[model samples]
Target chain A: METTPENTAHGYIRAGDKEKLRHRLRRIEGQVRGIQRMLDEDAYCIDILTQLGSIVAATEKVGLLILKDHMDHCVRHAVERRDEADEKIEEVVSAVERFLRV
Target chain B: METTPENTAHGYIRAGDKEKLRHRLRRIEGQVRGIQRMLDEDAYCIDILTQLGSIVAATEKVGLLILKDHMDHCVRHAVERRDEADEKIEEVVSAVERFLRV
Candidate 1:
Protein backbone atom coordinates (compact mmCIF):
# COMPACT_ATOMS: atom_id res chain seq x y z
CA MET A 1 0.00 0.00 0.00
CA GLU A 2 1.23 3.53 -0.74
CA THR A 3 0.29 4.62 2.76
CA THR A 4 0.57 2.75 6.04
CA PRO A 5 -2.82 1.81 7.37
CA GLU A 6 -4.37 4.40 9.69
CA ASN A 7 -3.96 1.69 12.26
CA THR A 8 -2.51 -1.58 11.18
CA ALA A 9 -4.59 -4.48 12.35
CA HIS A 10 -1.36 -5.11 14.31
CA GLY A 11 -0.29 -1.68 15.57
CA TYR A 12 0.98 -1.62 19.16
CA ILE A 13 1.25 1.98 20.24
CA ARG A 14 -1.22 3.64 22.53
CA ALA A 15 -1.67 7.40 22.92
CA GLY A 16 -0.13 7.50 26.37
CA ASP A 17 2.71 5.23 25.41
CA LYS A 18 3.89 7.64 22.76
CA GLU A 19 3.78 10.61 25.10
CA LYS A 20 5.65 8.83 27.89
CA LEU A 21 8.29 7.54 25.52
CA ARG A 22 8.86 11.04 24.15
CA HIS A 23 9.38 12.57 27.56
CA ARG A 24 11.92 9.91 28.54
CA LEU A 25 13.80 10.44 25.29
CA ARG A 26 13.94 14.19 25.75
CA ARG A 27 15.77 13.78 29.03
CA ILE A 28 18.15 11.32 27.44
CA GLU A 29 18.80 13.78 24.63
CA GLY A 30 19.94 16.42 27.12
CA GLN A 31 22.22 13.86 28.77
CA VAL A 32 23.75 13.03 25.40
CA ARG A 33 24.36 16.69 24.51
CA GLY A 34 26.10 17.12 27.85
CA ILE A 35 28.34 14.18 26.99
CA GLN A 36 29.31 15.86 23.74
CA ARG A 37 30.24 19.09 25.51
CA MET A 38 32.36 17.14 27.96
CA LEU A 39 34.13 15.45 25.10
CA ASP A 40 34.68 18.77 23.33
CA GLU A 41 36.35 20.29 26.37
CA ASP A 42 38.50 17.22 26.97
CA ALA A 43 37.01 16.52 30.36
CA TYR A 44 38.89 14.29 32.84
CA CYS A 45 39.03 10.65 31.89
CA ILE A 46 37.33 9.44 35.06
CA ASP A 47 34.63 12.09 34.83
CA ILE A 48 33.97 11.14 31.23
CA LEU A 49 33.86 7.51 32.25
CA THR A 50 31.24 8.28 34.90
CA GLN A 51 29.06 10.07 32.39
CA LEU A 52 29.58 7.29 29.90
CA GLY A 53 28.40 4.77 32.43
CA SER A 54 25.31 6.86 33.14
CA ILE A 55 24.54 7.08 29.46
CA VAL A 56 24.84 3.34 29.07
CA ALA A 57 22.54 2.77 32.03
CA ALA A 58 20.04 5.23 30.66
CA THR A 59 20.12 3.61 27.24
CA GLU A 60 19.65 0.17 28.72
CA LYS A 61 16.62 1.42 30.61
CA VAL A 62 15.10 2.52 27.34
CA GLY A 63 15.83 -0.85 25.80
CA LEU A 64 14.15 -2.53 28.70
CA LEU A 65 11.11 -0.35 28.25
CA ILE A 66 10.90 -1.28 24.58
CA LEU A 67 11.37 -4.92 25.39
CA LYS A 68 8.58 -4.77 27.93
CA ASP A 69 6.31 -3.26 25.34
CA HIS A 70 7.28 -5.95 22.86
CA MET A 71 6.41 -8.64 25.32
CA ASP A 72 3.13 -6.99 26.09
CA HIS A 73 2.25 -6.36 22.47
CA CYS A 74 4.28 -8.17 19.77
CA VAL A 75 5.04 -11.36 21.61
CA ARG A 76 1.56 -11.58 23.03
CA HIS A 77 0.05 -11.05 19.61
CA ALA A 78 2.28 -13.66 17.99
CA VAL A 79 1.51 -16.22 20.64
CA GLU A 80 -2.21 -15.79 20.15
CA ARG A 81 -1.83 -16.27 16.39
CA ARG A 82 -1.17 -19.96 17.07
CA ASP A 83 2.03 -20.04 15.07
CA GLU A 84 5.74 -19.64 15.79
CA ALA A 85 5.32 -19.02 19.51
CA ASP A 86 8.48 -20.85 20.54
CA GLU A 87 10.42 -19.33 17.71
CA LYS A 88 9.15 -15.91 18.59
CA ILE A 89 10.23 -16.44 22.17
CA GLU A 90 13.61 -17.62 21.06
CA GLU A 91 13.94 -14.52 18.97
CA VAL A 92 13.32 -12.35 22.02
CA VAL A 93 15.86 -14.33 24.02
CA SER A 94 18.38 -13.84 21.24
CA ALA A 95 17.65 -10.16 21.36
CA VAL A 96 18.23 -10.04 25.12
CA GLU A 97 21.61 -11.71 24.71
CA ARG A 98 22.54 -9.17 22.09
CA PHE A 99 21.36 -6.35 24.32
CA LEU A 100 23.41 -7.61 27.25
CA ARG A 101 26.57 -8.23 25.24
CA VAL A 102 28.45 -5.53 27.13
CA MET B 1 -7.88 -4.02 26.86
CA GLU B 2 -6.44 -7.36 27.89
CA THR B 3 -6.24 -8.47 24.28
CA THR B 4 -3.38 -7.17 22.12
CA PRO B 5 -5.97 -6.95 19.28
CA GLU B 6 -6.16 -8.89 16.01
CA ASN B 7 -3.53 -6.50 14.72
CA THR B 8 -2.55 -3.23 16.22
CA ALA B 9 -3.54 -0.19 14.29
CA HIS B 10 0.25 0.29 13.96
CA GLY B 11 1.52 -3.18 13.17
CA TYR B 12 4.69 -3.18 11.04
CA ILE B 13 5.15 -6.81 10.04
CA ARG B 14 4.07 -8.10 6.67
CA ALA B 15 3.66 -11.77 5.77
CA GLY B 16 6.93 -12.04 3.91
CA ASP B 17 8.78 -10.07 6.55
CA LYS B 18 7.79 -12.57 9.20
CA GLU B 19 9.07 -15.56 7.26
CA LYS B 20 12.37 -13.90 6.39
CA LEU B 21 12.93 -12.77 9.96
CA ARG B 22 12.29 -16.23 11.33
CA HIS B 23 14.82 -17.84 9.02
CA ARG B 24 17.52 -15.34 9.92
CA LEU B 25 16.91 -15.70 13.62
CA ARG B 26 16.98 -19.50 13.41
CA ARG B 27 20.44 -19.44 11.90
CA ILE B 28 21.62 -17.01 14.54
CA GLU B 29 20.25 -19.31 17.22
CA GLY B 30 22.29 -22.22 15.90
CA GLN B 31 25.40 -20.13 15.87
CA VAL B 32 24.77 -19.14 19.48
CA ARG B 33 24.35 -22.73 20.59
CA GLY B 34 27.57 -23.61 18.82
CA ILE B 35 29.36 -20.93 20.79
CA GLN B 36 28.12 -22.51 24.00
CA ARG B 37 29.67 -25.83 23.03
CA MET B 38 32.99 -24.14 22.39
CA LEU B 39 32.87 -22.63 25.84
CA ASP B 40 31.81 -25.82 27.54
CA GLU B 41 34.99 -27.69 26.68
CA ASP B 42 37.44 -24.88 27.32
CA ALA B 43 38.27 -24.20 23.70
CA TYR B 44 41.42 -22.31 22.80
CA CYS B 45 41.33 -18.60 23.60
CA ILE B 46 41.83 -17.62 19.98
CA ASP B 47 39.22 -20.07 18.76
CA ILE B 48 36.73 -18.82 21.30
CA LEU B 49 37.63 -15.28 20.48
CA THR B 50 36.91 -15.90 16.82
CA GLN B 51 33.49 -17.33 17.60
CA LEU B 52 32.69 -14.52 19.99
CA GLY B 53 33.50 -12.05 17.25
CA SER B 54 31.27 -13.96 14.90
CA ILE B 55 28.46 -13.84 17.43
CA VAL B 56 28.83 -10.10 17.95
CA ALA B 57 28.86 -9.53 14.22
CA ALA B 58 25.85 -11.78 13.73
CA THR B 59 23.99 -10.01 16.50
CA GLU B 60 24.85 -6.63 15.02
CA LYS B 61 23.47 -7.80 11.71
CA VAL B 62 20.24 -8.65 13.45
CA GLY B 63 20.17 -5.23 15.07
CA LEU B 64 20.77 -3.63 11.68
CA LEU B 65 17.91 -5.58 10.16
CA ILE B 66 15.73 -4.36 13.00
CA LEU B 67 16.87 -0.74 12.64
CA LYS B 68 16.14 -0.87 8.94
CA ASP B 69 12.68 -2.14 9.68
CA HIS B 70 12.18 0.56 12.30
CA MET B 71 13.28 3.28 9.92
CA ASP B 72 11.12 1.92 7.17
CA HIS B 73 8.09 1.34 9.34
CA CYS B 74 8.12 2.90 12.82
CA VAL B 75 10.05 6.06 11.95
CA ARG B 76 8.05 6.57 8.82
CA HIS B 77 4.83 6.04 10.70
CA ALA B 78 5.82 8.47 13.44
CA VAL B 79 6.75 11.12 10.91
CA GLU B 80 3.42 10.84 9.16
CA ARG B 81 1.59 11.00 12.46
CA ARG B 82 3.07 14.44 13.22
CA ASP B 83 4.32 13.37 16.59
CA GLU B 84 7.65 13.55 18.43
CA ALA B 85 9.63 12.67 15.32
CA ASP B 86 12.91 14.34 16.33
CA GLU B 87 12.80 12.75 19.75
CA LYS B 88 12.23 9.40 18.14
CA ILE B 89 15.23 9.91 15.86
CA GLU B 90 17.41 10.82 18.80
CA GLU B 91 16.13 7.78 20.65
CA VAL B 92 17.21 5.57 17.80
CA VAL B 93 20.62 7.25 17.64
CA SER B 94 21.07 6.68 21.35
CA ALA B 95 20.25 3.05 20.75
CA VAL B 96 22.93 2.87 18.08
CA GLU B 97 25.50 4.25 20.50
CA ARG B 98 24.58 1.64 23.09
CA PHE B 99 24.74 -1.08 20.47
CA LEU B 100 28.22 -0.01 19.40
CA ARG B 101 29.58 0.39 22.91
CA VAL B 102 31.76 -2.65 22.46
Candidate 2:
Protein backbone atom coordinates (compact mmCIF):
# COMPACT_ATOMS: atom_id res chain seq x y z
CA MET A 1 0.00 0.00 0.00
CA GLU A 2 1.19 3.53 -0.72
CA THR A 3 2.29 5.57 2.23
CA THR A 4 -0.05 8.45 2.85
CA PRO A 5 0.58 11.73 4.64
CA GLU A 6 -1.30 10.28 7.60
CA ASN A 7 0.91 7.23 7.65
CA THR A 8 3.60 9.16 9.38
CA ALA A 9 3.04 10.02 13.01
CA HIS A 10 4.19 13.57 12.48
CA GLY A 11 2.72 13.86 9.02
CA TYR A 12 6.17 13.83 7.48
CA ILE A 13 6.36 14.50 3.78
CA ARG A 14 7.68 11.81 1.49
CA ALA A 15 11.38 11.79 0.62
CA GLY A 16 10.91 13.09 -2.90
CA ASP A 17 8.65 15.84 -1.69
CA LYS A 18 11.14 16.79 1.00
CA GLU A 19 13.92 17.08 -1.56
CA LYS A 20 11.91 19.28 -3.89
CA LEU A 21 10.83 21.43 -1.01
CA ARG A 22 14.43 21.93 0.04
CA HIS A 23 15.41 22.93 -3.47
CA ARG A 24 12.60 25.44 -3.78
CA LEU A 25 13.47 26.94 -0.42
CA ARG A 26 17.08 27.34 -1.50
CA ARG A 27 16.05 29.22 -4.61
CA ILE A 28 13.72 31.41 -2.58
CA GLU A 29 16.54 32.03 -0.14
CA GLY A 30 18.67 33.22 -3.02
CA GLN A 31 15.92 35.49 -4.20
CA VAL A 32 15.70 37.00 -0.73
CA ARG A 33 19.45 37.53 -0.70
CA GLY A 34 19.26 39.25 -4.03
CA ILE A 35 16.65 41.61 -2.66
CA GLN A 36 18.91 42.40 0.26
CA ARG A 37 21.79 43.12 -2.11
CA MET A 38 19.59 45.50 -4.02
CA LEU A 39 18.77 47.30 -0.83
CA ASP A 40 22.42 47.53 0.07
CA GLU A 41 23.16 48.99 -3.32
CA ASP A 42 20.51 51.63 -2.70
CA ALA A 43 18.35 50.39 -5.51
CA TYR A 44 15.24 52.41 -6.17
CA CYS A 45 12.70 51.93 -3.40
CA ILE A 46 10.04 51.05 -5.93
CA ASP A 47 12.21 48.41 -7.55
CA ILE A 48 13.04 46.84 -4.23
CA LEU A 49 9.42 46.80 -3.25
CA THR A 50 8.56 45.13 -6.54
CA GLN A 51 10.95 42.29 -5.91
CA LEU A 52 9.65 41.89 -2.38
CA GLY A 53 6.15 41.59 -3.73
CA SER A 54 7.22 38.87 -6.11
CA ILE A 55 8.75 36.93 -3.28
CA VAL A 56 5.59 37.25 -1.25
CA ALA A 57 3.34 36.06 -4.05
CA ALA A 58 5.61 33.16 -4.89
CA THR A 59 5.62 32.10 -1.28
CA GLU A 60 1.83 32.24 -1.02
CA LYS A 61 1.48 30.08 -4.12
CA VAL A 62 3.72 27.50 -2.53
CA GLY A 63 1.64 27.40 0.62
CA LEU A 64 -1.61 26.97 -1.25
CA LEU A 65 -0.15 24.12 -3.23
CA ILE A 66 0.90 22.33 -0.09
CA LEU A 67 -2.48 22.85 1.47
CA LYS A 68 -4.10 21.30 -1.54
CA ASP A 69 -1.80 18.33 -1.35
CA HIS A 70 -2.54 17.84 2.31
CA MET A 71 -6.22 17.86 1.60
CA ASP A 72 -5.87 15.46 -1.28
CA HIS A 73 -3.51 13.02 0.40
CA CYS A 74 -3.84 13.32 4.14
CA VAL A 75 -7.46 14.21 4.24
CA ARG A 76 -8.36 11.59 1.69
CA HIS A 77 -6.45 8.97 3.63
CA ALA A 78 -8.29 9.95 6.75
CA VAL A 79 -11.59 9.50 5.04
CA GLU A 80 -10.57 6.11 3.73
CA ARG A 81 -9.63 4.95 7.18
CA ARG A 82 -12.94 6.23 8.53
CA ASP A 83 -10.85 8.06 11.06
CA GLU A 84 -10.88 11.71 12.05
CA ALA A 85 -11.90 13.11 8.73
CA ASP A 86 -13.81 15.91 10.27
CA GLU A 87 -10.87 16.95 12.42
CA LYS A 88 -8.57 16.79 9.45
CA ILE A 89 -10.94 18.94 7.48
CA GLU A 90 -11.09 21.43 10.30
CA GLU A 91 -7.34 21.57 10.41
CA VAL A 92 -7.30 22.39 6.72
CA VAL A 93 -9.83 25.12 7.23
CA SER A 94 -7.67 26.66 9.93
CA ALA A 95 -4.70 26.45 7.68
CA VAL A 96 -6.58 28.21 4.93
CA GLU A 97 -7.54 30.97 7.29
CA ARG A 98 -3.92 31.41 8.24
CA PHE A 99 -2.81 31.41 4.62
CA LEU A 100 -5.20 34.21 3.79
CA ARG A 101 -4.07 36.30 6.73
CA VAL A 102 -0.62 36.25 5.19
CA MET B 1 7.28 61.44 1.05
CA GLU B 2 7.25 57.88 -0.17
CA THR B 3 3.90 56.12 -0.08
CA THR B 4 4.00 53.46 2.57
CA PRO B 5 1.78 50.37 2.76
CA GLU B 6 -0.32 52.07 5.41
CA ASN B 7 -0.77 55.15 3.30
CA THR B 8 -3.45 53.51 1.17
CA ALA B 9 -6.94 53.20 2.61
CA HIS B 10 -6.88 49.48 1.87
CA GLY B 11 -3.26 49.12 2.81
CA TYR B 12 -2.70 48.74 -0.90
CA ILE B 13 0.66 47.55 -2.05
CA ARG B 14 2.70 49.96 -4.15
CA ALA B 15 2.45 49.81 -7.93
CA GLY B 16 5.81 48.09 -8.30
CA ASP B 17 4.95 45.60 -5.59
CA LYS B 18 1.62 44.85 -7.21
CA GLU B 19 3.22 44.25 -10.59
CA LYS B 20 5.87 41.95 -9.23
CA LEU B 21 3.33 40.04 -7.19
CA ARG B 22 1.20 39.48 -10.29
CA HIS B 23 4.18 38.20 -12.23
CA ARG B 24 5.29 35.82 -9.50
CA LEU B 25 1.77 34.45 -9.13
CA ARG B 26 1.69 33.77 -12.87
CA ARG B 27 4.87 31.73 -12.67
CA ILE B 28 3.54 29.77 -9.73
CA GLU B 29 0.34 29.14 -11.60
CA GLY B 30 2.34 27.62 -14.42
CA GLN B 31 4.18 25.42 -12.00
CA VAL B 32 0.89 24.19 -10.58
CA ARG B 33 -0.35 23.35 -14.05
CA GLY B 34 2.83 21.41 -14.68
CA ILE B 35 2.22 19.39 -11.55
CA GLN B 36 -1.27 18.60 -12.68
CA ARG B 37 0.08 17.45 -16.01
CA MET B 38 2.49 15.18 -14.23
CA LEU B 39 -0.40 13.68 -12.34
CA ASP B 40 -2.31 13.13 -15.56
CA GLU B 41 0.72 11.39 -17.06
CA ASP B 42 0.86 9.01 -14.12
CA ALA B 43 4.24 10.30 -13.19
CA TYR B 44 5.99 8.65 -10.27
CA CYS B 45 4.04 9.23 -7.13
CA ILE B 46 7.12 10.30 -5.25
CA ASP B 47 8.00 12.77 -7.95
CA ILE B 48 4.58 14.34 -7.79
CA LEU B 49 4.73 14.45 -4.03
CA THR B 50 8.11 16.12 -4.18
CA GLN B 51 6.84 18.81 -6.46
CA LEU B 52 3.88 19.34 -4.19
CA GLY B 53 6.17 19.84 -1.21
CA SER B 54 8.21 22.38 -3.12
CA ILE B 55 5.10 24.33 -3.93
CA VAL B 56 4.08 24.37 -0.29
CA ALA B 57 7.40 25.63 0.97
CA ALA B 58 7.56 28.29 -1.69
CA THR B 59 4.14 29.58 -0.71
CA GLU B 60 5.09 29.78 2.97
CA LYS B 61 8.21 31.72 2.15
CA VAL B 62 6.19 34.24 0.18
CA GLY B 63 3.86 34.75 3.13
CA LEU B 64 6.74 35.32 5.50
CA LEU B 65 8.32 37.82 3.14
CA ILE B 66 5.09 39.75 2.92
CA LEU B 67 4.66 39.68 6.68
CA LYS B 68 8.13 41.08 7.16
CA ASP B 69 7.46 43.81 4.68
CA HIS B 70 4.23 44.65 6.42
CA MET B 71 6.04 44.93 9.72
CA ASP B 72 8.86 47.03 8.34
CA HIS B 73 6.64 49.30 6.30
CA CYS B 74 3.05 49.32 7.50
CA VAL B 75 3.71 48.60 11.13
CA ARG B 76 6.56 51.05 11.27
CA HIS B 77 4.46 53.69 9.65
CA ALA B 78 1.75 52.99 12.19
CA VAL B 79 4.25 53.53 14.92
CA GLU B 80 5.27 56.85 13.44
CA ARG B 81 1.69 57.98 13.32
CA ARG B 82 1.22 56.79 16.90
CA ASP B 83 -2.17 55.63 15.77
CA GLU B 84 -2.37 51.86 16.23
CA ALA B 85 1.07 50.46 16.61
CA ASP B 86 -0.02 48.05 19.30
CA GLU B 87 -2.86 46.75 17.19
CA LYS B 88 -0.57 46.36 14.24
CA ILE B 89 1.96 44.48 16.31
CA GLU B 90 -0.72 42.16 17.63
CA GLU B 91 -1.91 41.52 14.15
CA VAL B 92 1.56 40.53 13.13
CA VAL B 93 1.77 38.14 16.05
CA SER B 94 -1.48 36.51 15.01
CA ALA B 95 -0.23 36.20 11.47
CA VAL B 96 2.97 34.53 12.63
CA GLU B 97 0.99 32.06 14.66
CA ARG B 98 -0.99 31.14 11.57
CA PHE B 99 2.11 30.77 9.42
CA LEU B 100 3.69 28.27 11.79
CA ARG B 101 0.55 26.16 11.84
CA VAL B 102 1.13 25.43 8.17
Candidate 3:
Protein backbone atom coordinates (compact mmCIF):
# COMPACT_ATOMS: atom_id res chain seq x y z
CA MET A 1 0.00 0.00 0.00
CA GLU A 2 1.07 3.52 -0.63
CA THR A 3 2.35 5.19 2.50
CA THR A 4 0.74 8.58 2.43
CA PRO A 5 1.36 11.28 5.00
CA GLU A 6 -2.12 10.76 6.34
CA ASN A 7 -1.43 7.05 6.84
CA THR A 8 1.77 7.85 8.72
CA ALA A 9 0.01 10.45 10.81
CA HIS A 10 -2.48 7.92 12.10
CA GLY A 11 0.16 5.21 12.57
CA TYR A 12 2.05 4.30 15.74
CA ILE A 13 5.10 6.46 15.39
CA ARG A 14 4.65 10.08 16.38
CA ALA A 15 6.44 12.72 14.32
CA GLY A 16 8.87 13.62 17.09
CA ASP A 17 9.55 9.98 17.86
CA LYS A 18 10.24 9.26 14.20
CA GLU A 19 12.80 12.03 14.16
CA LYS A 20 14.51 10.58 17.20
CA LEU A 21 14.44 7.14 15.60
CA ARG A 22 16.15 8.47 12.51
CA HIS A 23 18.75 10.19 14.64
CA ARG A 24 19.44 6.95 16.42
CA LEU A 25 19.74 5.08 13.14
CA ARG A 26 22.24 7.66 11.89
CA ARG A 27 24.31 7.24 15.01
CA ILE A 28 24.27 3.50 14.51
CA GLU A 29 25.47 4.11 10.99
CA GLY A 30 28.38 6.11 12.35
CA GLN A 31 29.29 3.43 14.85
CA VAL A 32 29.42 0.89 12.05
CA ARG A 33 31.86 3.12 10.19
CA GLY A 34 34.01 3.42 13.26
CA ILE A 35 34.22 -0.35 13.48
CA GLN A 36 35.29 -0.53 9.87
CA ARG A 37 38.08 1.94 10.50
CA MET A 38 39.25 -0.15 13.43
CA LEU A 39 39.31 -3.24 11.26
CA ASP A 40 41.38 -1.43 8.67
CA GLU A 41 43.87 -0.45 11.36
CA ASP A 42 44.25 -4.14 12.35
CA ALA A 43 42.47 -3.78 15.63
CA TYR A 44 42.28 -6.84 17.87
CA CYS A 45 39.43 -9.19 17.07
CA ILE A 46 38.25 -9.14 20.66
CA ASP A 47 38.17 -5.37 20.70
CA ILE A 48 36.27 -5.36 17.43
CA LEU A 49 33.87 -7.97 18.77
CA THR A 50 33.37 -5.85 21.88
CA GLN A 51 32.38 -2.92 19.69
CA LEU A 52 30.17 -5.29 17.75
CA GLY A 53 28.51 -6.24 21.01
CA SER A 54 27.86 -2.59 21.72
CA ILE A 55 26.28 -2.16 18.30
CA VAL A 56 24.04 -5.14 18.91
CA ALA A 57 22.98 -3.71 22.26
CA ALA A 58 22.31 -0.33 20.76
CA THR A 59 20.31 -1.81 17.90
CA GLU A 60 18.22 -3.82 20.33
CA LYS A 61 17.56 -0.66 22.32
CA VAL A 62 16.26 1.01 19.18
CA GLY A 63 14.07 -1.95 18.35
CA LEU A 64 12.64 -2.05 21.86
CA LEU A 65 11.97 1.65 21.79
CA ILE A 66 10.03 1.30 18.59
CA LEU A 67 8.15 -1.66 19.95
CA LYS A 68 7.17 0.31 23.01
CA ASP A 69 6.03 3.15 20.84
CA HIS A 70 3.93 0.74 18.82
CA MET A 71 2.30 -0.59 21.95
CA ASP A 72 1.71 2.84 23.42
CA HIS A 73 0.38 4.37 20.23
CA CYS A 74 -0.67 1.81 17.63
CA VAL A 75 -1.95 -0.87 19.95
CA ARG A 76 -3.59 1.64 22.27
CA HIS A 77 -5.24 3.36 19.38
CA ALA A 78 -6.47 0.03 18.09
CA VAL A 79 -7.99 -0.73 21.49
CA GLU A 80 -9.66 2.66 21.50
CA ARG A 81 -10.99 2.29 17.99
CA ARG A 82 -12.84 -0.94 18.86
CA ASP A 83 -12.95 -1.83 15.20
CA GLU A 84 -10.11 -4.30 15.42
CA ALA A 85 -9.43 -4.38 19.11
CA ASP A 86 -8.83 -8.12 19.24
CA GLU A 87 -6.50 -7.99 16.30
CA LYS A 88 -4.69 -5.01 17.73
CA ILE A 89 -4.33 -6.58 21.14
CA GLU A 90 -3.01 -9.73 19.57
CA GLU A 91 -0.53 -7.75 17.51
CA VAL A 92 0.82 -6.04 20.58
CA VAL A 93 0.94 -9.24 22.54
CA SER A 94 2.75 -10.92 19.71
CA ALA A 95 5.22 -8.08 19.54
CA VAL A 96 5.78 -8.30 23.28
CA GLU A 97 6.34 -12.01 22.99
CA ARG A 98 8.90 -11.52 20.28
CA PHE A 99 10.59 -8.75 22.22
CA LEU A 100 10.86 -10.90 25.30
CA ARG A 101 12.24 -13.77 23.26
CA VAL A 102 15.24 -11.63 22.55
CA MET B 1 14.37 13.15 7.89
CA GLU B 2 11.18 13.35 5.91
CA THR B 3 10.59 10.17 3.89
CA THR B 4 9.86 11.64 0.55
CA PRO B 5 9.08 9.47 -2.42
CA GLU B 6 12.35 10.54 -3.93
CA ASN B 7 14.29 9.45 -0.90
CA THR B 8 12.63 6.05 -0.92
CA ALA B 9 13.15 5.66 -4.61
CA HIS B 10 16.88 5.99 -4.10
CA GLY B 11 17.04 3.80 -1.02
CA TYR B 12 17.33 0.10 -0.40
CA ILE B 13 13.88 -1.51 -0.63
CA ARG B 14 12.63 -1.77 -4.16
CA ALA B 15 8.97 -1.06 -4.86
CA GLY B 16 8.04 -4.69 -5.49
CA ASP B 17 10.05 -5.86 -2.52
CA LYS B 18 8.37 -3.34 -0.24
CA GLU B 19 5.02 -4.79 -1.15
CA LYS B 20 6.27 -8.27 -0.32
CA LEU B 21 7.72 -7.06 2.94
CA ARG B 22 4.41 -5.48 3.91
CA HIS B 23 2.65 -8.71 3.09
CA ARG B 24 5.03 -10.59 5.36
CA LEU B 25 4.47 -8.12 8.15
CA ARG B 26 0.74 -8.52 7.81
CA ARG B 27 1.15 -12.25 8.10
CA ILE B 28 3.22 -11.76 11.22
CA GLU B 29 0.50 -9.52 12.61
CA GLY B 30 -2.00 -12.30 12.02
CA GLN B 31 0.27 -14.87 13.65
CA VAL B 32 0.62 -12.67 16.69
CA ARG B 33 -3.15 -12.34 16.99
CA GLY B 34 -3.52 -16.09 16.67
CA ILE B 35 -1.08 -16.58 19.55
CA GLN B 36 -3.18 -14.30 21.72
CA ARG B 37 -6.28 -16.34 21.01
CA MET B 38 -4.36 -19.45 21.95
CA LEU B 39 -3.37 -17.82 25.23
CA ASP B 40 -6.96 -16.87 26.04
CA GLU B 41 -7.97 -20.47 25.51
CA ASP B 42 -5.40 -21.60 28.10
CA ALA B 43 -2.93 -23.25 25.81
CA TYR B 44 0.14 -24.99 27.16
CA CYS B 45 3.10 -22.78 27.95
CA ILE B 46 5.35 -24.80 25.67
CA ASP B 47 2.91 -24.43 22.83
CA ILE B 48 2.78 -20.72 23.38
CA LEU B 49 6.53 -20.57 23.52
CA THR B 50 6.76 -22.60 20.37
CA GLN B 51 4.52 -20.13 18.58
CA LEU B 52 6.57 -17.30 19.97
CA GLY B 53 9.68 -18.94 18.62
CA SER B 54 8.09 -19.09 15.19
CA ILE B 55 7.35 -15.40 15.35
CA VAL B 56 10.95 -14.70 16.25
CA ALA B 57 12.16 -16.75 13.37
CA ALA B 58 9.83 -15.01 10.98
CA THR B 59 10.81 -11.61 12.32
CA GLU B 60 14.46 -12.47 11.91
CA LYS B 61 13.79 -13.50 8.33
CA VAL B 62 12.25 -10.11 7.67
CA GLY B 63 15.17 -8.35 9.26
CA LEU B 64 17.65 -10.40 7.25
CA LEU B 65 15.79 -9.74 4.03
CA ILE B 66 15.87 -6.02 4.65
CA LEU B 67 19.51 -6.15 5.62
CA LYS B 68 20.37 -7.96 2.42
CA ASP B 69 18.42 -5.40 0.46
CA HIS B 70 20.34 -2.66 2.20
CA MET B 71 23.64 -4.26 1.37
CA ASP B 72 22.66 -4.91 -2.25
CA HIS B 73 21.10 -1.52 -2.94
CA CYS B 74 22.16 1.08 -0.42
CA VAL B 75 25.62 -0.21 0.36
CA ARG B 76 26.36 -1.05 -3.23
CA HIS B 77 25.18 2.37 -4.30
CA ALA B 78 27.35 4.00 -1.70
CA VAL B 79 30.35 2.02 -2.87
CA GLU B 80 29.73 3.05 -6.46
CA ARG B 81 29.36 6.67 -5.38
CA ARG B 82 32.80 6.56 -3.75
CA ASP B 83 31.93 9.65 -1.71
CA GLU B 84 31.32 7.85 1.60
CA ALA B 85 32.13 4.30 0.62
CA ASP B 86 34.06 3.52 3.78
CA GLU B 87 31.22 4.70 5.96
CA LYS B 88 28.66 2.76 3.96
CA ILE B 89 30.69 -0.43 4.02
CA GLU B 90 31.06 -0.15 7.75
CA GLU B 91 27.36 0.42 8.21
CA VAL B 92 26.60 -2.86 6.43
CA VAL B 93 29.30 -4.77 8.31
CA SER B 94 27.86 -3.54 11.57
CA ALA B 95 24.41 -4.70 10.57
CA VAL B 96 25.77 -8.13 9.64
CA GLU B 97 27.54 -8.39 12.97
CA ARG B 98 24.34 -7.62 14.84
CA PHE B 99 22.38 -10.11 12.80
CA LEU B 100 24.88 -12.85 13.52
CA ARG B 101 24.77 -12.11 17.23
CA VAL B 102 21.26 -13.46 17.46
Report the TM-score of candidate 2, chain B only. 0.80
Cα lDDT of model 1 by residue, B56-78, tens digit: 77777667666656655654444
Candidate 3's DockQ: 0.03
lDDT digits (tens) for residues B2-89 of candidate 2: 3354343443345565456545545655556665555344443334545545555554555555566676677788799998899777
Say which prediction, candidate 1 or candidate 2, comes out ahead on TM-score: 2
Worst lDDT run of 10 residues, candidate 1 chain A, spans A1-10
Model 1 lDDT at residue A45: 85
Give me the candidate number with maximum DockQ: 2
Candidate 2 per-residue lDDT over residues A1-102, each given as its tens digit: 233543434333445664565566556556666654553444433344456555555556555555666766778887999899997777666566544555
lDDT of each: 0.66, 0.56, 0.56
Off by over 4 Å in 1: A1-9, B1-102
In terms of lDDT, the poorest run of 10 residues in model 2 chain B is: B1-10
**B33: Cα error in model 1, Å:** 24
True contacts kept of each: 0.00, 0.02, 0.02
Clashing pairs in 2: A17-B50, A59-B58, A59-B59, A59-B62, A62-B55, A62-B59, A63-B59
TM-score of candidate 1 on Cα atoms, chains taken together: 0.45
Stretches off by above 4 angstroms in model 3 are: A1-102, B1-9
Query: Could you give candidate 3's per-residue lDDT for residues B64-83 as a string of tens digits?
Result: 66666667776677688886
